[model samples]
Target: MKQDSTLVFIPSNLIYKQTGYLKGCKKCFENSEVYYVTSNKPIRNTYQYQCIGFVGETVDFKDSIGNIPLFINSKNGQLSVENNSSITQILYDYDRFKNSDLIHNQSEKYGQHFKYLSEKLKTTREISQNGRNSITKYILFLVQIFDYILKITRRIHQIVQKSSTFAHFEGNITTAKWFLTTLMEERKITPKVGNTICAKIIDLVIGVILTTYLFEYEQQIFDFINFNTEVIISNLRGLLLYLMGQPIGLKLNYSYNNFLGRFFLYHISLWRIFLQGLYPLFTGYFKFLVLPGFLGFSYQIAMISDVVSIATFHSYCIYIYAARLFNLQLKCLKSLWRVLIGRKFNPLRDRVDSCQYSQDQLFIGTLSFTILFFLLPTTMMYYVVFTVFRLITLTVYKCLHIVRNTMQTIPIYLLFLWIVNASSMAGNIHIAWKSFDDRGNVKIEAKLEKLPLLESVKKFIPESESPAKNPRGFGEIFHSILTGTIL
Candidate 1:
């Protein structure tokens, strides 16, 4: 008996195209009765078809959206058979059964993508952090340089106030050179490498020397005006006539006690270092006690002293105020007397000759003015030359090694001074103009209001705006631009 090769079932509502008998088969089977699963709606219907074929033979089935193909047993007409599924079924089964493999592949892909992104993010963050740190350090370094410049400027101002003559300027120049050298050398090895060390040294030295020369030239004019005619005549004539006349005048005026009194007189000099040492101790007390009690008391005292010193220096020459000229003159005369008179025999002559100022005509004509007249010029010249030379050498060194630009070589404090002066002038002008305008406006308004015709006109015309009412001035404009407030 042969089983059916094909089985077709027709439901009650469906039609059949083929209803043939089986041929050349061992068994023939009748078709199973078809049953339709129906819903209340006519469109919802279901049917099933089954066929038997030879074992291990390839079978083809129609591809439909809602169809499932299955193999059947041909001999027993049994529905049970091992199904060789479609590609879609194989993919679905693999996805369902291989859960660990799917998870592993997804995790590996995600991790690689995440690592790549993370590496990029880390690099970006590092660069950003480094840039911020670099900028912060650069700004801090610039601030230190600025502070140093301020300190140097203050020192320069102090030096200038101390000695008006060019000769004393040398000490200041030497100090400036040494300071700059130390600063540049330290900068080269420290937190910031100075880019213009050579240029700065060169420019500063040159500027100082030129300034000193100018100051000395002016000082010579000042000295010439102050010196007496006799001193000038003696210096111009180059004569020793003034030295011989001193002894006769001293013998005419001297008493024994007066002669002996000059020898025993003590010379006292004030030491600046003592005051400097006191400054630190006073500063601590100032910070802890004095400052809190009265704000800026110590600072005001310093400022007052500075002002007084400046006033004194401007009013009287440094040598006169310091008494150094008198001391130097006395020393010079004493040396001259020791050379001329024998040490034991002419004791009275030695005492009279050792006086800084001579009483006799010869000494008065030749060397009496030495204390004020000759010394001032010599001191001024010496200071001018020394300072100029020191400055020049320092400048050359700086030009060769450090400074690169003209602007960088200029002292920053000078520029600040210029700016301050200009600003002060501008402020004065602004204030003056504002005051004038405000006062004028009141008069104008009163007149306008009082006059009957003008008052009627004022009803139609707007009141004139005063200068005080005007918007920002030049200073405000400059400030706004500098602070980036009005961009």
Candidate 2:
């Protein structure tokens, strides 16, 4: 199947009954042909019929599709898999299961765009409808079972305390807030770790691993990419400057050269396959890594926080998380946002039209141009600088016997960093803000409250009234302080 057209296995009898079916059918199809799969002939004249097959529960196909199972359900009228959700629907529901490999690959490989997902499903379907084995079938079965078990537990808990957040008031922001708070409080304790220690441990492990691995080989990684790609990076920058109307003979400043030199050297594609792939792989987990660190580090503060502190911290966390998501969405919305916000009615319309618009464009274009020329040389350079700086300082201290041993030095610094972070310096530079954000709300303090009046007041207060200030230039953008709806 070269995908000359769409492959539809519509019910044979209804093909001729064109109830905008043709429209949905035609738009998707690359070619005019529609393959029909049915057990019986059409009741009326068929538009196109190429395949004949019976789709039932115990039956399997010979076509070599991907290992994932696909089945047609006559009962629900869904193209489903293993009696779960519809195949088409699940494929459409990106990130429903964040841990899923298929979902992860969708973002990394295909940018998780609708067109890409749709095309992928179409191609995979037409490629081959190979029958999967009992092994895959069993694994899916277990997943479904676990999902069912979780759902049942949640449902049971819902009965004890109402599932609805604001049970009386249908749906609103207040209701949503209450419900979410309830959910977090309801199951505050879990089997393995009390106080969400698992999240903390994970953060510690990842931080240690990142620090050690990156610190040790930082120079090596830098040099390897730099020495090999220097000429190409230089020549490429010169070319870019020329294209931008800058003379080729113009002397480049250290800043300009540094910026260009780092771009290509940071790229993963130029490296051995395994290494390059790791960058995005690491990036995609940015939130995961960050959240754990923030939550874990600030965990104790949360337990002791007063009404205002608690409300602010929780609300801020949600805001930051949501902002992070918004940022991610913004990345995807580039060209799309330009057209959308260009509309006068759009919320960000003014921001879109401002003089900063060109600056933003230039910034994006420059960054893209850098990436286009070379992968991530700038990123690697920054990382190596940090690593070297930390290592050199530690080395000097140790050589002077001021820092006696690795165990004493590292732990002492780490603890000092923790204290500094917990003391609110974390809210400044270096993602210690993440740790600070995790300080739990003491207002709730393991108690479930129906009306968090104080929290509500805390939520609505103007930013100017709040004494807290973030030095980070982009803090306002990332730190969300929702006005109301505190629970």
Candidate 3:
């Protein structure tokens, strides 16, 4: 399923005639000598040349020959052939391909007609609401605005890139390399050791500022944190009580549910008392964390956040317990059902195999399956509730880290370069049509090409982690949720 990676050979004169015209003469190269050559050169001019047509390769016949379409089959990644036609153009690489204006006249002619049709379709969708809600429509509007701006910016960038005058600058190789390194990679202005020292200095300054502020209001911050912890504990206790008595209309096994709820409630109470006892130690530790925060690492701040989340450490423990119990019960139910059906799972083969179970074993399996099946709902309810709490905590932590990372990694150097002299940030080289020689050969000249300012800056900046892209993918999480598997 590989394409012929061998080179394609077409007449230079044929392409030259096609290059500078609004519409190329189809038969301009009808009699042109085009050959398909192999890369292997075991023999010289003794090798037979397979003469191809202007657009499609030809087959010799006794009297007449026919033209056949030769194209790459996208699905199979192979060269394919069909009769009577050839692929004149390929609309691949949609984004870059459409952005190009190499065949300007043809593109404009088609573009004008398609523009009206596109507008009509969009208007029709808008009138119909397209099954979109108000929020969806608003979000779509924002997206459209963003896309329009991006498109216009890219178009301008393309124009500048192709223009010979725009990207020309008088600079040495060192300056050029520095510009490219700053724009196309992480902005590294100094040696590695120097960068490390500079980073340490910045961290020290930030740490000092943060430490000064925190120390001044240490009691107040600790008091606020303790008060929030108490409120959270009270709220959690209330929730457990409500769950024990069926807050929702759905009926649950009251005795078992109550037992679980009371156990967690007791755990929470103990955790609160323990936390109160360690208030002084935690306060001192929190103060000490300012030093690491001053070192200006996002992960250091994340570590502090993790320690802060320990206020709900007991809730996390409950979640782990419930998740494990639920998971174990599910496994037990599955195994017992398999046993009842006289089949056992073989780990080595990774398949179920039939087995002859004794009557007593079958009875025991049936009893176990029935018990676990009935208790599953209760276990799941606890697991799901605690998982929600855990997710909320994680979301807050992730947000804080994202904010910190974003602030710390802002491309200030790239921004300054962009402001002072944006053309200096060029990372690409473009070959422009310079002139034609006396022999009618096209002369080309290479020029430095300007990269899109936003795109270049974005490249240099370390992006913050997106909340949607979690440790597990969306499909995995969805499957886990549907199957009642622990997150």
Candidate 4:
């Protein structure tokens, strides 16, 4: 008898790793060939005796609709040669295939609530004993250290202000702005609050200060006590331009408030997030490959890069907000389009709430990794080396903050401390929870429900059979109900 039919396997372990599947396959396909196709290589099933890894894409799978093929691949294995004429080819590309595995695993294991894959599973005992060994704790720890140093910086400002014509700005927020003037004056850069030329000079001074914090500074070497204690902030374009070593412009986002304009706006933010994520990886690669540096500056540069990582974290937070904003804007535009076209559309009026999103929680979750990465890829570090690396990281972080809030009257340190405390308190009380779910999909508990907020975040942390129907995003509960859909 000649081999007659095929059973196509996805680039997933669930298909191959199940016990007795190969034996079942062997018995069923005794004559027919079983094709194991994938783009990326799969890890061998160590449990099985005849396990083999599948690497690279094989024959591309084409879908035949209307005409049912001899075989149709289902999530559960139920296809055979007798029931079907041919096996349906499920072509697996490298990126799409791996992502499929991630989604499948998360859904299979976690079901409804999707969490970060890299996040270690914590037991109740572990949670009680060590707390969540999450990046949030590391961020909180590093942030506390910076908070203390901010107090010192405020004292320095107080003393410095006494001697200069600059009066003490009262609010905690003004400490940073006031400090910028002090820094400019100290550098002989000439602070002119009333003069346009002076304003440009101040920006020049700030720019130099920003570059010094970002690149290298003399004080960074000597100021061991004031480690990672510089303040800094940069607009998206400026940071990209400096890091990439070329002047680049933003993708033209035209907002005409018309049909075309709204459509473009709806799509723009989603693409923007991908671009932002790529930039950090780009900077990381560029530093390691293109920008060669001495081993001496290795740790120092690594420390500075901590701020870069944190900035990336901040950008991710912004991306989340952008996503939320786009969701609302898109829904309205879609509604308008339906109305204009005289389509049956239900206006959801009950669940309307102010568009409020949290930027801090996302930062909190990523902060741990930002600090952790500054220490390098070492899993085990000597105690002394770890302490020193931490100190270096703190120094760099502090420096960025100091530069960013240079002209502020209020101490940025205290403000940061407040945010941390607020985030922690609110989160524990169910006000501002941060589950740090895979990508941007966040399912909150109390605070969100009390306020009756909608989860506008979509296509993030996708689950296979999500109870929250539309993984692309089930809009506000009210909207779902109005549409007679329970997403």
- Estimated TM-score per prediction? 0.18, 0.16, 0.55, 0.16
lDDT of 4: 0.32
| Best-performing candidate as measured by lDDT | 3
Give the runs in model 3 whose Cα sits over 4 Å from its true position.
1-208, 284-286, 297-300, 422-424, 433-445, 462-470, 482-486
Top model number, TM-score: 3
* Model 2, TM vs. native: 0.16
TM-score of 1: 0.18
**Candidate 3 accuracy as lDDT:** 0.51
Candidate 1 structure quality by residue, lDDT tens digits, 47-143: 3312222221232444322332332233432222123211111001111111110111123412332223223222222123446556656656765
Shift of residue 448 alpha carbon in model 3, Å: 1.7
At residue 323, give the lDDT of candidate 4: 41
Candidate 3 per-residue lDDT over residues 1-487, each given as its tens digit: 2222112222112322111111111111222211221111111222232222222233233222223223332233222323312222211121222122121122332333223322322222212334436645554565565556545545675553332122111111122233334322322232222223343456457656776777789889888888888898889998888888866786788788989998998899899889888987877687665554554444345555656557768888898888788878878988898998889999999999999999999888898899889888888888889888877776776576565545444555556654654434543434345444453333333233345667655555533322221468769877766555656
Q: Rank the candidates by lDDT, best first.
A: 3, 4, 2, 1
Q: How well does candidate 3 score on lDDT at residue 333?
A: 86
RMSD of each: 37.6, 30.1, 20.6, 31.0
